[model samples]
Target: MTFFQILAVVLTATAFFAYLNYRFLRLPMVIGVMVLALATSLIVIGLDGFGLSLADGAARLIAEIDFDDTLLHAMLGPLLFAGALFVNLDDLLAQKWTILLFATVGVALSILLVGLMLFHLAGALGLDIPWTWCLVFGALISPTDPIAVLGILRKLGVSKRLETKFTGESLFNDGVGVVAFLILLEIVAGGDAGAIHVASLFVVEVGGGVALGLVLGLAVYWLLKRVDNYQVEILLSLALITGGYAVSEMLHLSAPIFAVVSGLLIGNVGRRYAMSEHSREHLDTFWELVDETLNALLFVLIGVEVLVLNYPTGALPLGVSAIVVVLLARFVGIGFLVGLLRARRRFSPHSVTILTWGGLRGGISVALALSLPPNPWRDYLVTITYIVVSFSIIAQGLTIGPLIARANADSSNPTSD
Candidate 1:
């Protein structure tokens, strides 16, 4: 399919499902679109079973678009930038210690625990995935997608404090997670690097990305300070995202990290001092629309991409088991961090539970899984990732609102924490 044809189909499907969601489902827009698309995909599969060949054509269309390349290279910068743009910098700063801990140490802990547990589980289930590959899955899935988490939290009415924690951790951890994934991928691909070498690479990728982002952000902020026109400022913002991300990739740095840092700077500093009121309003509205539209299309693609996966029946149990394993790993990771923080600072009641359950895996996880180098274990990993991400986004995502409500209730009770 031509790019225009593909874009037309995606936009048409997104609009139809979004309307369906608005009119009837009334679920979160991204989740609703995904559910509808998944149902459509299943129907295609069923039709294929009946020898209709519809599934084949659908799969071909899906294959025509490279999911990993499209998301990681093209979509991610805008998505991350939009999410970070509107974040309250004051709230983020207030929660800096906790956010830093969760984004770095907590992510590391989750990766290790998930990797170990998945490795053992696969062995017990008669699967032959190596520990390293399991670690790759761990690295990919550990980071709660900022795009998904922030979107859901926007509608859930969670406490500002808790929402800050969720959003802040998600914003940074995905970059950290991607760095870890690349490191593990190297090891899996027989890089034969020692611990010191791997650690050095991590430092370079992460540190370089951060430095580049700060420079880009400050430069853009300076330029915006001299501009009064909303049109000009908006164009600058676009250039910041596209140009900054491209430079990060060329420098072999973490593009997501660059996006997050630059976004934070632009959304906060630029909006505060650089942009006129009119410009600020226009910028905010523009990014909000970008975030929403991209989210709709991304989730729809995620759901439809299921048609292209090869799900061996034998891996069904492994996929189911992976869901539990991921949740447990999240529980352990969040529980440990919350416990340690509680001694020094109080958290909202059930913060651990809320954080664990709210740790959503979305397009980022699927993209990473799909990007895995082709191997005997790749299909299994992708299947398990799809199951876990689908359940995470659809099930846990749907229920997180109530969980937040309960947490709020618990916080209001004097007898509770």
Candidate 2:
């Protein structure tokens, strides 16, 4: 099958499975779609492994769908932008110290920690991955995808402050994570870079993107103030995410961070000055719908793209092992930092724990996996990443509800959800 044909199949299958989940299983829609997709991949491949008729021409057809390109290059920019554009600025500003610290310093620390361990771990598993590449994976996976987690959190309905902390941290940290990936990628490729060079790179990527985002956001807000028409303003915001992101990419800026800064600019700074109360309400509803629709498509893409990733049955054990390590590393990083952040006693222990667990990896991991140079080890990396992210969104994302419920039960039992 051709690329478009394969994409069509993936989308249609995702929709069908999503409907089934919506109708019967009644699971988290995104998680359900992924669960169904993984099931389908296993069944089809398993049938083939057994020498069944389903094996004929199926694997080849599935192979044509590039999970990497479809997710990272295509889906991630828009998803991140859509998620960030309507966030609460005051809440975010309150936790700015915490979020900024975690996003920048915390992400770097986690990446180094995970990379050192994975470097040794991969060698133990007899995998020949370079140290730089391990760090590449570390940087990519370290930043939490607030898109998936916030979706799950919204359903769970926790405290307003905790929700803001999760959203704010996730937004900024994703940017830090992406910048870290680029820095490591440069180092891996033998670019003329050192600590000073990396520091300079950080300022340009993060600072420059923030400047551009603020300018664009101010422009959008200024435009919105002139016209009370909600429809036009909404279109302009959409254009901001898509066109703004493309322009940032063309300028060689960080798209993830740019999307984030732009979102914050429009959501926070511009929000007070530009939008009328009605327009704010309108934009929020509009962006919420945009977020909802894109989320479904991204999750469905995750499910359908499983058929597209390459590997053999022999690697399944390795895939499971990689999942274990990523989970272990994430637990270590989040758990350690949660204690540090809450030691100031501003955030509740319960709120902090839920946020830690809510750090579900999603589109960014898929994107970075696809962004890898196509090499012999690329497929293994993809398999490992898919397994880790899937486990995060499905297992951790779904279980976050129970955790939050218990937290609430202990603190504010009488507070109506």
Candidate 3:
């Protein structure tokens, strides 16, 4: 009944399913646990719909779970930080240009395209939503999920250079995507603010976010150097996720960016100075455990939280339409941008293909959909977003390995990493 007790029960159940999947199923841990949880919850719901014995108790219990808030608020910070921490700092820095363009420019294109397409489609369906609302959806969904992609990428045996580009872009892209979402919100909420002011606001949100992240990262790194206790150091990094996220959010800065900067600083800049040999080993083990544990909880939350959602039956068409528009926008954005990059010497055609397939949507999309204001259509939006996110994370995340293998097969030498 109490909050902490509920969390303990949820986490215990999630871990049990995750272990089962990891040992026997050989499925990607997140997808496996999520699918299992989803099926089980649906079974309970189906029984309730038919008035089966005990359905009431089961359905009520599942309905108490909140998928949206759990992912967006509690799990996302640590998940993104863990993903960013594992990335090779050198490779990320090398393709910094491509990452910036794809993350920043590519996101803008996807948002504008999806918004306009959805706006028109909604009108045809006799739905009258403001363009601002559609743009809000676009911002929320534009970020390619770093946690999901990197999980697959770790299993991807692509060239190191190519892998770095994909991993780096995916990590920063989420940060860029979230910033885009906030910008769209400002436009919706900023009734009296002019265009020039909005542009200025964008700069401050992004620039200020990056600057704040760097400063916080350095400050943490300096504090870390004076300590040699691995347990204590790991706790500091954990604090960076929980405390750092809380502070950044309070200051209206980007929590996702702040976590990434702090993680990367410890992983790269402070790797030598801040950690002793014993501390390094413990730190790595500590975070890997954190990463996997949170990942398990995230997928389980994604699956069971659907039970609590209140999707409207009225806007199913609009919600479905948004899914189609986003899929098309992704194809166009990835195809055009990556193609243009390849043509101008950014990456090879093969490399571009893998990156395109690698744009996996997961927790962030659902979180954004959940973050939406409750309107008549919000229910439809959340349900549809969940559908799309489930497909992307499970279907795409599962198959990306084969794509990477095929793409890398022709090369004489490749990393089996």
Best candidate per lDDT, number? 1
Clashes of each: 0, 1, 1
The TM-scores of all predictions, comma-separated, are 0.96, 0.89, 0.90
TM-score of 1: 0.96
Instruction: Provide the lDDT at 290 for model 3.
Output: 85
For residues 107-201, what per-residue lDDT tens digits would candidate 1 score against the true structure? 99989998999999999998978988999999999989645555566675555777788788988998999999999998888895798898899
For candidate 3, write residues 1-417 as lDDT tens digits.
677877888888898888888788878787889888888778877776676755556546655656657776687788778777777688778777777788878888988988888788878887776788788777777777645556566665455666676667667777777777767766676653587876776677667667777887788798898988888888888887888788877887777777777778778876667888888888888788888888888788788766776656546666666667877887788778776676554455465456656677777888788777656667766776777777777777777787767767765443322
- Ranking, TM-score, top scorer first: 1, 3, 2
Identify the leading candidate in terms of TM-score: 1
Question: Which candidate, 2 or 3, would have the higher TM-score against the true structure?
Answer: 3
Query: How far does residue 183 in candidate 1 sit from its true spot (Å)?
Result: 0.5
Q: On a 0 to 100 scale, what is the lDDT of residue 277 in model 2?
A: 84
- Candidate 2 or 3, higher lDDT? 3
Q: Write the per-residue lDDT of candidate 2 for residues 1-417, one digit (tens) a residue.
A: 666787687668867887898998888777887788778767876886677857446556655656556655566666677667667777777777777776777787778877777777778777767887778878877878666566656666655666776777787887788888888888877896778999998888888788778888778878877887778877888888778787877887777777887877777755567767887788888877767666777776676557667774445666677666666676666667666776673656464456557778887777777788866667777777787788888888778877877877788541121
lDDT per model vs. reference = 0.89, 0.73, 0.74
